[model samples]
Target: MGIIQDITNIFKTKPKKEQDKAAVDRREKQDALHKAFSDIQQQRLHGIISTLKELSTNEEIKANLKQTRHYKEFEEKVTDIIETYNRKLDHIDPSIKESQKLTVLPIVEAKLKELDKWCEEPTKTDKTLIWKNIGNVIKHSLKAIKNIGNKGYTDEIEKVRYYMKAVKNAKQNTKEAKEEVRGATKTFNS
Candidate 1:
């Protein structure tokens, strides 16, 4: 009966990591959307500048506009949009630089370096010891990383580490799958 129960547990459906997947998906989508919007805004500003340049180039149009009452209003409106977009562009660069700097994760980097140094020599005696070693690594990681924002959820370091762990597992699985596929391809071609 215990053996049957253990077998059932082994085949049991695990809970989905909904938060982790949603966060990664949301961040990627938001970044792509912001880039697209920035591109569109840049194009619109360039189009406005081109229009203003054309207005300045034509003698008749310039003379007529200078004589008209609406010319000052038109000039002000166009100039305002140009200045507004200029200000927007100016503000964007510094913020981007700041955010890029914030993604450093200093403590995380240190811990990763430590792991690299430790992993340089194989010290595991058995399978259980290897699993315990891995758990300790994760425990230290959770403690080392205090916090990381930018995942759209300003969650704890533990949560962020969970996301990274999930990604690492996925990447490992993908690499193994590719290797298997390549091996199979060679066999089939032969």
Candidate 2:
């Protein structure tokens, strides 16, 4: 019986300690990876926010943001996060993977969607032109009104008169060109 008991003990020896140690090692690796990924995510998020702030005020920076390469960098960073989490999940259970996906995917999708929308807007130059043309007209009108009080309205009136004369000349030239074309067409058809 004693010999049998010794044989049984040898055969039934527990592997719980080794299993626990392996679990600890796996957890340590996962924690380190998560920490590293968190750091990278922090840096990337900071960079993107800073870039966005600059872009909001700087036309050149805004143009850069519209570039495909910049968005591609953002995509790569998002993909990195997804891949990192997937690798970490390989060491974890199924339940945790679902939770991680729930937390991460939506945030990534929303950010990308915002960037895409911003890219679809008109370029800074077009916006600037629209504002400049409208603003100039408003400024000129205000100046003309102010000149009426100063009795210096003659200069503004002359400017308008010159502008009108230029318009009339352009219209006259266009009419002449159309008449010449019509005469040439009639001659050719005849």
Candidate 3:
């Protein structure tokens, strides 16, 4: 009985070489799919960015907003935010092995969506929400840095920290500028 069972098992099992070849083929197919998906995601991100750029320079928005006392400052800040967002996206290394970029992508997409909405409906109260979205991007960035095996000391990590710090400073400067604009408006109105 044992001999017969052994014979049946030998006949049922695939050869080791065939199994290895199949595994390699499967992995190759998976990799190709991943690469194709990544390319699509990259294209979508570019489109969003281009849309944001156009919104930033939107003639109607510009015409409506240009009458404000701090319109120039607002325009500059919007440009700065867009540039900073681009920098943040570009700072991500492409060679990360674990699809960390994909994990970060949705967060970036969400931030861009928020920015798009904010651009469409410009309001002073929404600045906090914009900063919140920016903060989420920065937080996800830090997570990406950590996931890549950096001990929070690499040049990449430092640059992310610097960006975080720069954002803080920008927020502060924005508050001060807004106050000044308010004071100037009050004086002009009086």
Candidate 4:
């Protein structure tokens, strides 16, 4: 029974290599899906831009609009939209300059480095809270990265900011509590 239980446990917990391979596979799948979605969005934006350009160049439409006081405003708005969409397309284009892209691994690694520095200092907060906050930060950061070019990206980034603030607040509260405890102990002694 002991040997059977041990075998079952071993099978239940995946080997490190298998787990690493599964993670790699999952990431690859996610990246591929993201690229596909980005490509589709880029194509749709290009189509919209082309349609707008065609309408803008139409002489009859241009002549009709030229007579209106708002013609200049319409032209300006259309131009602005085109330019903005083009910039967005450039941002999502994988072929763009490397500097323009957000590399997730490096950013996460930098954050981890900061976390290491912060962890070196002991605090009164429980170990679980510190670890939980750290996990939340990483979670939100990844969510932000996953949402790049999407409407939710800003929201995810904001969540990460909130978690960071929470950590800071936790540390501050712990210090204040410690100080209060020390004062009470002194008063008791007196």
Candidate 5:
């Protein structure tokens, strides 16, 4: 009877141990998954910041508006956007996984350099010069997006459209102002 009782007790203890081990493994896996998700989210946020910086520094965007009446207005708008985005991004944990930073940093740096060049001299009198430079910047931005292996083409294209509209509006306003001056001169001469 003693031997039989001991055998039953041992069987029960083994199952309880096995159950505890399995529960621990499950918890560990859950924690790992959560960590991975958090890391991915951070990377995406960084990508957003990189894209915004590229748009801010794009030379063609700057050149189109530089001499326009709305130049300051547009600059203020863009600056605000960048500041707001940066503030939000800064709230993210600063600790980034090493592998991710290695892959993301260089592409972001290159994009930023291109943007800085654009901002330095936003526009010149040469129509073709401004558009051509802008086209090149857009191409470079697209390439960076590709290198990052993300899907932001639509957003990027929208950014191009925004600048294009600004250029077009500036040109129209300049034309209207010239016409107004011409009318005033004709009246004065009469």
Candidate 6:
């Protein structure tokens, strides 16, 4: 029985060439996206990455942000907000990866989930509120940064303001790149 199963498994598995091709395809897609994002945008994406990093631990969550029954709605709302942010980022730099930047809504949801888990603990504190506030600031920062094309940064928290400026810088870089492309495409006929 073992010999027969081994023989079947060998035939079921895909060959190395096919797997290699798939891997190459994935890399090409990733590179294409990365190439579309300019150097400045990439720099901004990497810089200030810490601001978005999770600060709240599971042990910190004293209670759920909402009732268990509302998890679905909470999920949808988080996803919508994240997708909106991603859309704005795509406008600024198509190559930028929100997931890696931890700007993705899913990452935010995961942090919230950790908060929920902490909420399960009998003992509770203000940490839940703090995490929620931080999450809001993060989301607001994304929205405000999206507007940096015209409005620029606000005089809010110093850390968030710095990241907002980075967003503006990225937008400026994208704008300049677009102008350069337009200039290159323009034709002067004799």
Q: Write the per-residue lDDT of candidate 4 for residues 1-190, one digit (tens) a residue.
A: 9999999999899999999999999999997887776554444334434544643565644654454454565466556555655565466656653323333224333543443344333222333344455446545655554565688866876776676555546555567989999999999999
* Top candidate by TM-score: 3
Which of the predicted structures, 5 or 6, would earn the higher TM-score when compared with the native?
A: 5
Clashes of each: 0, 0, 0, 0, 3, 2
Candidate 3, residues 33-134: lDDT per residue as tens digits?
887766655554444345445435756445444544445655665566567556766777767733654555555545545444544343444444334433
Task: Locate the minimum summed-lDDT window of 10 residues in model 6.
Answer: 54-63
lDDT tens digits, residues 165-189, model 2?
Answer: 3332433555688999999999999
Against the correct fold, how does model 4 do in TM-score? 0.45
26-145, model 6: which lDDT tens digit per residue? 999987775554333434432323333322212222123332343344445444444554564565443544334434434444544453443343123333333344444455444434
Q: Per-candidate TM vs. native? A: 0.33, 0.34, 0.49, 0.45, 0.39, 0.26
Please give the distance, in angstroms, between residue 72's alpha carbon in candidate 1 and its true position after superposition. 3.5
Per-residue accuracy of model 1 over 1-190 as CA lDDT, tens digit each? 9999988986784435765788889999998877665554344334434433444444544453454344464455445544544554555556474343323334234444454344333334322222233334333333433322233222433443453344335435556889999999999999
Checking candidate 6 for backbone clashes, the offending pairs are 33-95, 63-119
Question: How displaced is residue 117 in candidate 6, in Å?
Answer: 18
CA displacement after TM-score superposition, residue 154 of candidate 1 (Å): 39
Residue 173 of candidate 5: its Cα lDDT? 58
TM for candidate 6 is 0.26
TM-score order of candidates, best first? 3, 4, 5, 2, 1, 6
Candidate 5 per-residue C-alpha lDDT over 69-94 given as tens digits, one digit per residue, 9 for 90 to 100? 54574356446545655554455455
Over 4 Å off in model 1, which ranges?
1-26, 56-58, 97-190
Q: Model 6, residue 135: displacement in angstroms? A: 2.2
Candidate 5 local Cα displacement, residue 41, angstroms: 2.2
